[model samples]
Target chain A: MLEPVMFTGGVYKHDLVMELVEDLGGYVLQKNVTQSEVILLLLVPKEDMEALKAIISDLRGELVRAPLAGTEVAVVTPTLAIHHLPHTACDIAEYLRRNGAKSNMIGLARGVGRETAQINEYESMLIDEHDAVVFIFGNFVECIRKKEFLYRNINIPVVVTGGPEIPKEELPYAFEYVPSVGRITHRAKKATELGTLDKIIESVGRALDRTRTDISKDPLTTSPPRVMDAVREQVPEVEYSFSPLPIALNLNGVRIKLPYDKHKDAVRAVKFDEGVTLGEVATIRPSKMKDYILVRILPMSETGFVF
Target chain B: MDPMEVFKVEIAGEEFGAKKYREIIMDILQDLGLIRSIGRLYVYVDVKKPVFAVYGLLRTGIPPLLVRDVADVAQAQGGFQIKVNDEEHMSDLLKVLWAKYGRERVEQPSRDVVVVATDTSPSDLPVADLEAEFRQDLTDALLRIAPEGFRNRRNEMTDKSFFFIAAEDTLKSELISEVKEKIRSMENA
Candidate 1:
C-alpha cells in the first residue's frame, strides 16, 4: 500500500527527502517552494513511512498523513458575488488545500436566487471533472433543502455544507452534509469554525474512499500515476502548458493539459513496458474544462488483462 | 456586549439563523467601520417568505472630510503647500484642488505634497462627502449581509436613518408593508 504524506521544512536539504522517496520507489506528487520553506506531497510505501519520518525528524521537518493527496476537489459556490466569495468559500478552499488536495474554486454564472438558481450544462460538466465536490450553501434550512437541483445531475460524490443541522435523509442526493459553515463575513479563526473545516476534510476523505472502493472492484488496467509517468515522458509539450500542475490526476484517469485536437494522437501513442499503447487501454476525449484532453482507463474486465 | 445600543435580530423559525445573522451583520459593519455610526439596528428575517429587512438609526451626521483633515496645510512662497498625511484620500484632495483652482494653479511637487496657488485657505474645502461615502459602504455591507438569493432589494435612506429590505421574490408594496410591520414589532421588543 502507498501512503500519502506531506513534508514541510526549510529548503536547505529538501532534495534529500525527495531523493529518499525516489529511492524507495515512491512518487513526489507535487513540490512547492515559498521563499525559505518547501512543501512536498508524496506517495511513499507504507512500510517505509517510518524511515521517511526518521529523516524528516532529523531535518526538523513536519510530516502529516494527507488522505486527500493526489486528488482534485472542487469548491463550488452559488455565485462569485461578494455575498458568497472571499470569506466562506475561500476559507473552505484554503482548508482543503492545507489537507493536501488540489482544490479548484468554481463560481456558477446564474447560481443565485431560489427560483433562478441553476447549473448550466457547461458548469455541471466542469464540476464533474473533479474527484469530488463540496457545495457551499447558506443559512436557511428551506433553501438548503430546495437547492438539491444543483447537484442532482453531478456524477461524482458531493459533500454539501450549510448553516443549520438537517437530517441526512432529507438530502438524498448529497453524499454527506456538513453544518455550521454557512454564510459568514469573517475569516475562520474560532475553534468551532476550524473544527467544522476539519469535519469537511473528513467527509471528503470518506467520499474519496468510497470511490476508491468502487474502483477496486473493477480495477483499471493500469494505475493513474503510471500513466501519468508515461504521458509525461512521451508528451514533452505538456510541460509547456501554463497550468501549474500540467497533468491533473483523477482516481480513474488523468487530464492532460494539452489541447485535444492537436495532441490527442501524441497522447494516444504513449507506450508502456508491457508493450501496450494508451489508445488501446483508455478512452481519449475532449475535456469539459478548456478543451483539454481527458483519458479514462478501461477496467480489467474490458481489457481482459492487467499489466 | 453589543456594539449598538439596541441590536435585535429576529428570525421566524430558526433561532440559530438569528444568532448567526447577528454575527454576520456585526462582522460586516465592523469591517466597514460603520458600527459606531449606527445607534440602533433591528433585523427581521422570514425564511418561509425568504425576506430580510434591516432598519438602523444613525448616531449623527458625519461631517465632510476636508483637505486639512487629511494633511498638513502651510503657506508656501507662491501657493499653500499641503503635506498629505493620509495618502488614501490624496486623489480626492487633488481633484478638489484642481476643480477649485484651475489645473495650472495646482502642482504636486513631491509624492505627498500638493501646492495650490491661492490666497484663500483651502483648509475648509470639502475633499469628500463622508455622508455619501458612508451610504455607499452601508449599501455594500447590506448586500453582503443578505443571503445570496435575495436579489430584489429596496433601500430607503434619509438624513438620520436607513431602511433596507431584500427578498428572493419580487419586492412588492404589500411585502414592504409586511416587513415594516415585522421590524416594528422587533424594535418594540
Candidate 2:
C-alpha cells in the first residue's frame, strides 16, 4: 500500500526529501516552491513511512497525511456573479486545495433564480470529470429542494451545502448535505464559521473515500501516479505547458494538460517497461475543460492483465 | 442588539429564509456604512410569488458640507486664501472655486491652500452635497441587499424614506401594492 503525505519545509535540503522518496520507490506527485518555502506531495510506501519520517525530522520539515490528494474535485456555484463569489465559493475552493486536492471552481452560466436556474450538457460533462462535486446553494429550503435537478444527472457523488438544517432524505440525489454555509458577504473568520468550513472539508473527504472504496473493488491496470510519471518522462511537450500541474492525477487516470488534437498521439505512444503502450490500456480523448487531453485507464477485465 | 429602531423580515412560508434574509440585510447595510442612516427597515420577500420589497425610514437632518465646515477662509495678499482643514473635500473645494472664479483666478499653491482672485470671502460656498451622496449610497446598498435573481427592480425615494422592490418576473402595479401592504403590516406589527 502507498500512503499519501504532504511535506512542508524550507527550500534548503528539500531535494534530500525527494531523494529519500525516490530511494524508497515512492513517487513525488507534486513539488511547489514559493520563494524560500517548498511543499511536496508524495506517495510513500506504507512500511517505509517511518524511514521517510526520520529523514523529515532530521531536516526539520512538517509532514501530514493528505487524504484528498491525487483526486480532482469541483466546487460548483449558482453563478460567478459577485453575489456568490469572492466569499463562500472561494473559501471552499481554497480549503479543498489546502487539503491537497486539485479543486476547480465552476460557475453555471444561467444558474440563478428559483425557477429559471439551469445546468447545460457542457457544464454537466465538465463536472463529471471530477471525482466528487460540492454544490453551494442558498438559505431557502424551497430553493434547495428545487435545485435538486441541477445535480441529478451527475454521475459523481454530489455534496450539497446550504444554510438551513434539512434532512438528508430531502435531497435524494445528493450524496451528503452540509448546512450553515449559505450565502455570505464576508470571509469566514469566526470560530463557528471556521468549524463549518471544517465540516465541509470532512464531508468532501468522506465523499472521496466512498469513491475510493468503489474503485478498489476493480482496480485499474496501472495506478494514476505511475501513468503520470511515465507521461511526464516520455511527453516532453507537457513541460512547456503553462499549467502549474501539467499532469493532474485522478483515481482512474491522469489528465494531460496539452492540446488533444496535436498531442493525443504522443500521449498514446507512452510506453511502459512491461512491453505495453498507453493506448492499449487507456482511452485518450479531448477533455471538456479547454483543449486538454483526458485519459481514462481501462480496468483489468478489459485489458486481461494488471501492471 | 439590533441597530435599527424597527427591523422586520417576512418571507411567506419560509421561516429559515426570513431569518437568513434578515442577517443578509444587516450585513450588507453595515458593510456599506448605511446602518445608522436607516431608522427602520421592513423587508418582505415572497419566494413563491417571487418578489422582494424593502421599505426603510431614513434618519432626518444630515446637513450639507459647506466651505466653512471643511476649511478656514481669510483675507490674504491677492484675494481670499482658504486653508483646507479637511483634505477629504479638497477636490470639491477646488472645483467650486474654479466655477465661482474662473480657472485663472483660482490657484492652489499647496495641497491644502486655495487662493481666489475675488475680494469676497469664499467661506460659505457649498463644496459637496453630502446628503445626496448618502442617499445614492443607501440606494446602492438596498439594491445589493436584495437577492441576485430579482432582475426587474423599482426604487422610490422621498426626503425621509425609500421603497425598493425587485422581482424575477415583470413587476406589476398589483404586486407593488400587495408588497407595500405587507411591509406596512410588518411595520405596524
Candidate 3:
C-alpha cells in the first residue's frame, strides 16, 4: 500500500526528502517552492513511512497525511462574478488544495439568478472529468434546490454547499451537503466561519473516498501517477506548456496540458517497462478544458490485464 | 447590537433566507462603509416572484466640504496661499479655485500648497459635495447587495430617503408598486 503525505519545511535540504522518497520507490507528485520554503506531496510505501518520518524529524519538517492526494476536485460556482468569487469559492478551493487535492475553480457562463441559472454541456463535461465536484450555492433553499440541474448530469459525486440545512432527501443527486458556507463578501476568519471551511474539506474528503472505494472494486490497468510519470518522461514537450502543472493527476487518469490535436499521438505512444503502450490501455481524447488532452485508463475487465 | 435604528428583512416562506440575507446585507453595507449613513432599513425578498427591494431612511445633514474645512487660508506675498490639510480633497479644491478664478490665477507651488492670484480669500469655496458622493456609493452598494441575477433595477433617491428594487424579469410599473407596498408593510410591521 502507498501512503499519501505532504512535507513542509525550508528550502534548505528539501532535496534530501525528495531523494529519500525516490529511494523508497515512492513518487513525488508535486513540489512547490515559495521563497525560502518548500512543500512536497508524495506517495510513500507504507512500510517505509517510519524511515521517512525519522529523516523528516531530523530536518525539522512537518508531515501530515493527505487523504485527498492524487485526486482532482472542481470547485464550481454559478459565475466568476464578485457575488460568487474571491471569498467563498476561493476559500473552498484553497482549503481543498491544502488537503493535497489539485482543485480547479470553474465559473459557469450563464449561471446566475434563481430561475435563469444554467449549466451548459461543455461546463458539465469539464466538471465530470474530476474525481469529485463541490457546487457552491447561495443562501436560499429554493435556489439551492432549483440549481440541481447543474450537477444532475455530472457522473462523479457532487458535494453541494450552501447556507441553510436542508434534508438529504431533498437533494437526492448530491453525494453530500455542507452548510454555513454561503456567499460572503469578506474572508473567512471567525471561528464559526473557519469551522465551516473545515467541514467543507471533510465533506470533500468523504466524496473522494467514496470514489476511491468504487475504483478499487474494479481497478484500472495502471495507476494515474505512474501514467503521469511515464507521459512526463516520454512527452517532454508537455513541460513547455504555460500551465503551472503540465500534467494534472486524477484517480484513474491524468490531464496532459497540451493541445489535443497535436499531442494526442505522442501521449498515446508513451510506453511502459512492460512493453505495452499507453494507447492500448487508455483512451486519449480532447479535454473539455481548453485544448488539453485527457487520458482515462481502461479498467482491467476491458484490458484483460493489470499493471 | 445592530448599528441601525431599525433593521428588518422579510422573505416570503423562507425563514432561512430571511436570516441569511440579513447577514449578507450587513456584510455588504459594512464593506462599503455605508452602515452609519442608514438610519433605518427594510429589505423584502420573494424568491417565488424573485424580486429584491430595500428601503432606507438616510441620516440627514452631511455638510459639504469647503476650502476652509480642508485647508488653512493665509495671506501671503503674492496672493492667498492655502496649505491643504487633507490631500484627498485637493483635486476638488483645485477645480473649485480654477472655476472661481481662471487656471492662470491658481498656482500649486508644492504638493500641499495652492496659491490664488486674487486678493479675495477663497476659504469659503465648496471643494466637494460629499452628499452626492455618498449617494453614488449607496446606489452601488444596493446593486451589489441584490442577487447577481437581478438584471432589471430601479433606484429612487430623495433628500432623506431611498428606495431600490431589482429583479430578474423586466421590472414593470406594477411590480415596482407591489415591491414598494411590501416594503412599506414591513416598515409598519
Candidate 4:
C-alpha cells in the first residue's frame, strides 16, 4: 500500500527527499517551490514511510498525512458575482486546500436566482472532472430546496452548504449538507465561523472517502500518481508549461497541463516498468478545463489485470 | 449594539434568513458609513412573494462640505492661496477651484498648496454635497443588501427618507404598494 503525505520545508535538499521516495518505489505527485520554501506531495510506500521520515527530519522538514492529496475537488458557487464569492466560496476552497486537496473554484455563468438558476451541460462536464464537488448555497430553506435541480445531473458526490439547518433527507440529491456557511460579505474570522469551515472540510472528506471506497472495489490498471511520475519523466516538454502543477491528479485519472493537439502523441507513448504503454491502459481525451489532456486509467475489470 | 435608532428585518416564514439579512444590511451600511445617517431602518422580505424592501428615515440637514472646511483660504499677491489640511478631499477641492477659476488660473506649486488667481475667496465654494453622496451610497448599499436574485428594483428618495424595493419578477404598482404596506407594519411592530 502507498501512503499519501505532504512535505513542507526549505527548498534546500528537497531533491534528496524526492530521490529517497523514488528509491523506495514511491512517486512524487507534485513539487511547488515558493521562494525559499517548498511543498512536495508524495505517495510513499507504507512500510518505507520511516525511511522517508528519517530523510525529512534530517532535512528539517515537516511531514503530514494527506489523505485527499491525490484527488482534485471543485468548489462551485452559484455565480462568480460578489454575492457568492471572496468570502463563502473562497473560505471553503482555502479550507479544503489546507486539508491537502487540490481545490478548483468554479463560478457558473448564469447560476443565480432561485427560479432562474441553471447548470449547463458544459458546466456539469467540467465539475464531473473532479472527485467531489461542494455546492455553496444561501440562507433560505425554500431557496436551498429549490436549488436541488442544479446538482441532480452531476455524477460525482455533491456536498451542499448553506446557512439554515435542514435535515439530510431534505437534500436528497446532495451526498451531504453542511450548514452555517451561507453567503457572507466578510472573511471568516470568528471561531464559530471557522468551525463551519471545518465542517465543510469534514463533509468533503466523507464524500471523497465514499469515492475511494467505490474505486477500491475494482482498482485501476495503474495508480494516478505512477502515471503522473511516468509522464513527467518521459514527456519533458510538460515542465515548460506555465502551470504550477503541470499534472493534476484525480481519483481515477490525471490532467496533464500540456496542450492536447500538440502533445497528445507524446503523452500516449509514456511507457511504464510493466512494459505497458499509457495509451493502451488509459483513455486520453481533451479536458473540459482549458486545452489540456485528460487521462482516465481503465479499471481492472476492463483491462483484465492490474500492474 | 445597533447603529440605527430602529433597525428591524422581517422575512416571512424564515426566521434565520431575517437574522442573517439583519447582519448583512448592518455590515454593508456600516462599511459605507451610512449607518449613522439613517435614523430608522425597516427591512421586509417576503420569500414566498420573493420581494425585498427597505424603508429608512434619514437624520436630514447635513451641511454640505465647503472648501473652507477642508482648507485654509487667504488672499495672496495675485489672487488667493489655499493650504489644504484634509488631503482626502484635495482632489475635489482642486476640481472645484478649476471649475471656479479656469484650470489655467489655478496653479498647484506644491502638493497641498493651490493658488487660484481670483478676487473672490473660494472658501464659500461647495467642494462636495454630503447629503447627495450619502443618498447615492445608501442606494448602492441597498442594492447589495437585497438578494442577488432580486433584479428589478425601485428606489424612492425624499429629503428626509428613502424607500427601496427589489423583486425577482417585473415589479408593478400593486407590488410596490403591497411592499410599502408590509414595511409600514414592520415599522409599527
lDDT of 3 by residue, A49-71 (tens): 99999999999999999888888
Best by TM-score: 4
Q: What's the candidate order when arranged by decreasing DockQ?
A: 3, 4, 1, 2
What is candidate 4's lDDT per residue for A141-259, written digit by digit as tens?
A: 99999989999999999999999999999889999999887878889999999998988888888999899899999999998988998999999998899998899999999999999
Those runs of model 2 whose alpha carbons end farther than 4 Å from true positions after fitting are: none
* Docking verdict class for candidate 3: medium
Q: Report fnat for all candidates as fractions from 0 to 1.
A: 0.68, 0.51, 0.80, 0.56
In model 1, the runs with Cα more than 4 Å from the true position are: A57-60, B71-85
What is the lDDT, from 0 to 100, of the residue B22 in candidate 3? 89
Cα-based TM-score, every candidate:
0.95, 0.96, 0.97, 0.97
Model no. 2, DockQ: 0.66
Worst 10 residues of 1 chain A by lDDT: A108-117
**What digit string (tens of lDDT, one per residue) describes model 4 on residues B1-189?**
996789888888898888888888887888898888889998888887788898999999989999899999999998999999999999999888888789999999999999999878889999999988988898888888888878999899999889998888899999999888888777777
Off by over 4 Å in 4: none
The alpha-carbon lDDT assigned to residue A3 of candidate 4 equals: 88
Q: Which has the greatest DockQ?
A: 3
